[model samples]
Target: MSRILIVDDEPHLRLLYETELRRAGFETMTASNAVQGLEFVETMEPDLVILDIRMAGMDGIEAMQHIMERDQRVPVILNTAFSSYKDNYLTWAADAYLTKSSDVTELVETVKQVLEKQATAHG
Candidate 1:
């Protein structure tokens, strides 16, 4: 099964995402903050990561950078509540970026697109 790691500081966000991804037939994992996220990347070995850009300590950009260093091929999708952050996401190695207000269907589609595209390239 395809695996996904969701990193969000908001408890509800994590739960909602986890539930949604699970219902979509993806094996899901969660990390509440970037610190915990790094650990999950090392241990959970998720095929894709849905990361929140605005976090307490290590933001999504920094987390994406670190994750890239560990596994350059894995796709990391960055999401943020603030529109301003969208402009700066290109500098990071994140595979994709979308606003939090984006519809759940869009989010799911984006994730599938990214992973399928990556898998095609990798395979």
Candidate 2:
């Protein structure tokens, strides 16, 4: 099973993602903020990370820089509600970018597809 790290400021968002990803057959870990997310990644070394860009402390972009430094192969999916910042967000390196309102089916399919691509590239 593929392991995934989900990071969001909202506890409910993490819970929703955890449940949905679990149903999709992925082992999931949840973190309420980027700091915890980074620590979890250090220990678990998940195959992918789904992150929210508007965190309070260390935002997703900053945290992602650290994550990439440690594990460049670990794909990241950046989700943001602010559509206006799309250009700014794209400057950050991410394997994928998803809007927070994206359909659940699309989210699931995208994650799976990214995981498959990551597997192939690393294999």
Candidate 3:
């Protein structure tokens, strides 16, 4: 099973993503802020990271940079409430970019697709 690190400031989102991803058969871990997420990236070495664009401190863009610096191979999915960040060049660094929604089906599908694509590339 692939391990996914979910980084978001919202508690509900963390729980929701964790629950749904677990149901989908992926192992999951969550960080409430970018700083902790970066730490987890280094220590836990998750196969993929689902990062939020905006947080109280150290936004996802900056955190993604740090994560890439540590290990470029790990895939990152930028999950944000704001669609405007999609136009930003920094977000392009992520393997996938998804806008938040009430329904999480898209998010789950994207995670599966990204991980599958990564497996193909590395395998």
Q: What is the lDDT of residue 87 in candidate 1?
A: 68
Candidate 1 residues 19-114, lDDT tens each? 888888999999999999989888878899999988999888888888888735678998778778766745356778888863677788899999
Q: Roughly what TM-score does model 2 have, to 2 decimal places?
A: 0.92
lDDT of 2 by residue, 1-123 (tens): 999999999888788888888999999998999999999988889989998989999998888888888835578888877765578854358888888863567677889999989888879
Q: What is the Å distance of residue 111 in model 2 from its true position?
A: 0.9
Q: What is the C-alpha RMSD of each candidate to the true structure, in Å?
A: 1.5, 1.5, 0.9
TM-score of each: 0.93, 0.92, 0.96
Kindly report which residue stretches of model 3 are placed more than 4 angstroms away from their true locations once superposed.
Answer: none
lDDT of 3 by residue, 27-61 (tens): 99999999999889889989999999999999999
- TM-score order of candidates, best first? 3, 1, 2
Residue clash pairs of candidate 2: none
Backbone clash pairs in model 1 (N, Cα, C under 3 Å; residues 3+ apart or in different chains), count: 0
